[model samples]
Target: MTDSGERNTMTRRTVIGAGIGAGIGGAAALTAAGFEPAPAFAGGSGKTVRLTVMGTTDLHGNVFNWDYFKNAEYDDSAHNDIGLAKISTLVSAVRDRIAADRHAPRPLMLDAGDTIQGTPLAYYYAKIEPITGGHTHPMAAAMNRIGYDAAALGNHEFNYGLDILRKFQRQLRFPLLGANAQDWTTGLPAFPPYVLKRVHVPGEKPITVGILGLTNPGIAIWDKANVENKLKFGGIVELARQWVPKVRAAGADLVIASVHSGMDLSSSYGDALPYPENASVLMAETVPGIDAVLVGHAHLEIPERLVTNKTSGEQVVLSEPLKWGMRLSLFDLDLQKVRGQWKVVARHSQVLNANTVDADRDVVALLQKDHDKVVQYVNSKIGTCTEAMSAATAPWEDTAALDFVNFVQADAVSKALAGTPQASLPVLAIAAPFNRDAAIPAGDVSVRDVAGLYVFDNTLLAVTMTGTQVKEYLEFSAQYFKQISGTGPFPSDQVTNAPTSTAPNGTPDYNYDIVGGLTKPLTYKIDIAKAPGARITDLAYGGTPVAADQQFVVAVNNHRQSGGGNFPHIKTAPVVYNRQVEIRQLMIDYVTTTGTVDPKTFHTTDWSLTSNGTPITVTT
Candidate 1:
């Protein structure tokens, strides 16, 4: 046996050919970060097995490049390329690349879940014309046509319930796997744990590769209504420890983890919880036999990151493609004959921009009917906005767009709590500016406009908390802004996210909350110059100092009620009511029921940000 400079132990083959065809994403916009061109290989007297692994995560029911928000093809968002149609195009391009050169074998296509929910299109199928109700789900059909080998279940899979998830699993040709989600009665895997596949080359023996699937353990809390009595989710690391060896024992030469989770190691739900939301990094560091990890659920795009396994001191490749079908994780594996047996010589991972490729006309034709239906539904007028409401200044100031969202919740819950124990209690609602770029036209408001305001499928929950608890929640949210010192008439662009880039935009927009129903102005300043958790000051309510236990019913989404954001006091707070309906639908109902949203009546100047007793000039 002989070795070269590129084969000492582990060598990275960077460039996967002259790629990046120009489309929506120009040549300059296409980037495969941390990737280099492949070096020339020496033709030896050994069998070579060259194959590609293509993956997508957090598809969230996008079958076309159309946006339900704008009621047209997507534009001016973080991601230009969207849906399985675009992904199908990328898949063919990769296959063509392989065919042109080695033509070794067909590529393995995979997905890390969150496939069923996000847009109105997914909702239309899951709720309106369910597959169980004899309708073909668009996501399932598109993926089946694309030919997925295997997939992991995402936490959102349970948002609709077990019956719906079971129906979806049965509808697909490939197996839907979840190693951690277990049956409550038997403490056994609820779905298939892992799948083994054999790749047969023309002149070589069949090579066995195992795909292990893992889902976010937050299913226990986030979907407690759907999974509580029937299933329990275990920790990814602990469960991987149990399942990896079993898969290897089942005649697998290589193992891949299709993990529907993120790479953050810190436990967001605290250490006592069995599994925190983001633990992919921990899974790679501790688990053995895992060659690579495909991650999702945090909606981050990590082109390539190498993790060192602590047990064997071996390197494992981890890749997370951007959500909404914006990017694909393309990994190429080089296999060489070893003493008459073929083994992987090296592995290379990188992200391919979905916008760089054109959408497959065939896939679009397959789902065009479903796409048209969603467009029609979203375009229907729901009501009217008396004045223009824009989220453009929401991140910096308490804009009218947020006041409209907050008022909807506060009013709806106030009526929902009638005749209940918390009926007489004063109510306030907490809402985040989900769309930083959303704007509602002055004249007519469509169902799409209101749906765009509350992008997530969150449910409403009214929890009893003190005025002090409300202040504490606001303090937790103030952590979303950055620390800015030497303040003058600072523009709102200075009002972006907190410095921690755990996510691409630092502090996520979902964490920034604004409240309604305060008697006095809820003017608490976020001193960006100070550290998080210590930045909020001037907390007051109703023109008087708030006492520790001055109770009030605060309306929030089920995610917060399920302890999603790791905010203090909210998860442990007493719940007065839990509405199992979608909050977006409620907003739809609110606007239509009220007939008109006069910004003059609902918009409030209840919040402000000041430096040295003078408010900074915020302009985004």
Candidate 2:
């Protein structure tokens, strides 16, 4: 490999010919094969230039084969074949191709975070057997084997406390870069904001690739308690503005934003309006020095390279590999020097499916070892269920599995609070239907099923809220559903019309749905901006009118209890009871303790909407 300063002198023709020959099997054939060869422009005279970037995001602990929870073998038609083993194969193949082309640019492999905490393995690690000498995170182990260049922290990284997060960073083989995350008290970066590396391209000058990482500011709202003491996450755009120039000053010729955010362009107002789903696009447009963006979270698959600035129209590539190790994103970029500056002349992005490629043996072996250990730890049968508890349907409506989960959670909270001074107070439990659309079918309960039911391992918390607070909370939760125009099946428009918003400008009212334990014939309309205490109406607890001073015990996940999900009354509610119990454990305990659970017990007592002066027939 030549030194960085000597790179410009390299002969472009020799490099191009050699690269074409090795990568395409024929220099003349590839040109004839319709491959758009890089153009020899301005200062890029005889310099050979080739660079390849491979990325994956939102892996969600799918290091092994698909449906591991179901124990089903790989089947293409069933969407069954996706794993790190397969991803490793593609990585090796790309590396070999780059090697064969003596003139191609060096390759870099990266992950956009959200790697280890979404699957059964993560659940077992966090809730069952904690790794890292009780600090080690299994996701770090999995990522180490995959050989990431650098990783940007996703919001889920903060799901656990600072200790666990720090351990994960310490355990990683590569640096965790996040420009926006800072120590809450000092307002200084908690980790390095970016990393600059010299990549040696065969037959050309070493290219300085500057990689900057940023995550969504949503961490404050989603993980308030866990991150409250340790760190404060800043806005992505502000951080980008602050760091883009610094990265350039640090001698980075090409800047890539490894953002744990997303991009969306569907707006009534042209690209100027902020697209909640596609924050990456806005970041790219606002940050002048950024050349490309690799995004995650929101688990989307957007392969196209978008151009936001129509005037200069510089290309800004945005990509997110399909979650669960289902796909790999490859960014093939052609870099050329123009007046002492490098510009991306052309680029292409593609998703690699496991079924389409063979697995890399080395990567496979590494992941298999971890996979085996996790399987052994979670394989033991805890108990059996007479009826299959499933959450297969959307959680908003009644499903056997969700109903059972709410019932178990509520019962556990009530029992835990029963010995307190306020034990006899009416107890209300709230749970978000995470397994919407029955991802776990109604059947025998297994460790995998349990993991899927409550993947986050949130603790159970009980607080005291008044009848008025209870009614408002239910209305907020009801916002998850839209008033369908005639209910003709699931309306496509319902998604945009969702009653609740998770955006920065969203309404302040809490939207958590309350399950059972309430005897009020409460009625209320949703007024998003009404004062917290004023939205609820005709509220009563048990058979009596709720006294403004009378407090009622409410069961909620630790997230809500600590104001993580934006529930208003929860943050102020006195903790009647707090259990260091995992949501999954509560479900399992409920099943084992009761021997059998029925769906009828999980009925909703908190939601009702008025339409045309009369209550509309609500199903959930």
Candidate 3:
């Protein structure tokens, strides 16, 4: 890797042959049987170069197939594996195959961001043994060993602020690209917008592939406190339009966009900004020079998608590997020299499942100590609980588990607002049943127990809203339930996980919010018999009917406060307090400082669902 600050370039010595492998590992040999280069035309000259680009995104700090929150091996309903350890094995196998063939170009390893935040390992480095204190982040240590050529900046990369992010960037072996992340003062690209790589093919001129990176524009709203005036995020499509042309003019033979946005053309912020949050498809459809795109940020697994450019009339390939290193995206492009220049003639992409490969031994050995430290950290007992509290019923019924989260959040916000002008306003807190399996054991409570309650890396904030707005917020959240005709006993699955335009598959667990009050209980019923906008009924605070004009200070997470779920009025609501404290750490701190997990002090049966005022019975 050569770094000139203006142009970062790398040369690939080993080029793959025409025939690419169809397997996850290198066992399947590459032969010339399947692929045949185009015949030489009248003026066509030179050889066919086969180049491969492998990508991973939203890696969220998983280096092993282990869940620190569960204190066990990672296992979900899908039975999918995760972490860079598994990804390294697949990368090594592919590289080994390329080397043995002697005709394949050395594969380029790239990531599409979200590398620094997620899991207890990420949290320990960010807050406990802070990388800012000169300690190397576990992610930097492991990824450096993996030897990534370049990586795009993800929105979560800024969760810990610029200081930690810069430190992590300085420790890396390659440049971190962010084209749309501009300096507010200069309105220019803050990080290296793109990187150039010259693939050296024997007996032919080197093939130059330019990689451009773009981040989510919603960062301007999602992380307003951390980057309000310091940085400005631009739309992905516009940024691609501006930078892809520059990359082409730089003499790149092929242009690949490593974008940290989803293929869906949608925004969670709902017109709060000019740009949509996930616009990879829109960018591909509008941008002409792009040859391929590695998509991220939505955490969905899209093996391959082809979007045709409107202006160029060229088909562009796009792929997204599942998040948390569950899969790897591979792009194989065969280029032929035409008119004295290398031009891509044929290209295709596919995803390899990470579960099929074992964790790379070297990667596991490199970070064994770091992994052990996090395991110890999460397993340490912080407090004791008199009775177990589970979130299993939180989705359909008011459970003490979710109440515990609201209790801790509201208490903190209320204390922070004390002596301030907002002290007179009632403090309410919002929480979601992120994990139905999250539970506080009866006898002892560990960090992982509380961490399981809130899986996302969200921070706490205090926003001001009127009683009318609060009702509107609840009404919007009530849309998570499907409309039922009668109040007879019904299966929980039948009543929940309704589909919306924003969420085609069904509403995610994070989108359904539960609001609770601090000093007094905030009670309301979700009327499933009514339509979405009018679902909230019996809205009251402290047993008094909530007045539409009554003002309240609500404790909320960064995601919801920043318009993540498109909940009404929260993003536009005035922020009364913004401490930028992670909610997971806050709960851990509360338990450690208090030395007891008594739900009696925090839990309140404040909310329920009903059918026209008759309580709706739900069976789990």
Q: Pick the candidate with the highest TM-score.
A: 3
User: Which of the predicted structures, 2 or 3, would earn the higher TM-score when compared with the native?
Assistant: 3
- Screening candidate 3 with a backbone cut-off below 3 angstroms (N, C-alpha, C), the clashing residue pairs are 14-104, 14-105, 14-106, 15-103, 15-104, 15-105, 16-104, 16-105
lDDT of 1 by residue, 329-378 (tens): 97776677777655556667888777656666667677767876766667
Q: Tell me how candidate 1 scores on lDDT.
A: 0.76
Of the pair 1 and 3, which is ahead by TM-score?
3
| C-alpha root-mean-square deviation, each candidate | 9.8, 12.6, 8.9
503-613 per-residue lDDT for model 3 (tens digits):
889898789999999889999888899988888988999999999999999999988887899999999888777655679888998888989888888777788888888
Q: Model 3 TM-score?
A: 0.77
**Against the true structure, what is each candidate's TM-score?**
0.73, 0.64, 0.77
Give the whole-model CA lDDT for all candidates, comma-separated.
0.76, 0.61, 0.83
Task: Please count the clashing residue pairs in each candidate, in the order shown.
Answer: 7, 19, 8
Error of 1 at 11 (Å): 53
Best by lDDT: 3
- Kindly indicate the candidate among 2 and 3 with the higher lDDT: 3
Residues forming the 10-long window of minimal summed lDDT in candidate 2: 13-22
| Candidate 3 all-Cα RMSD | 8.9
How much is 588 displaced in model 1, in angstroms? 3.6
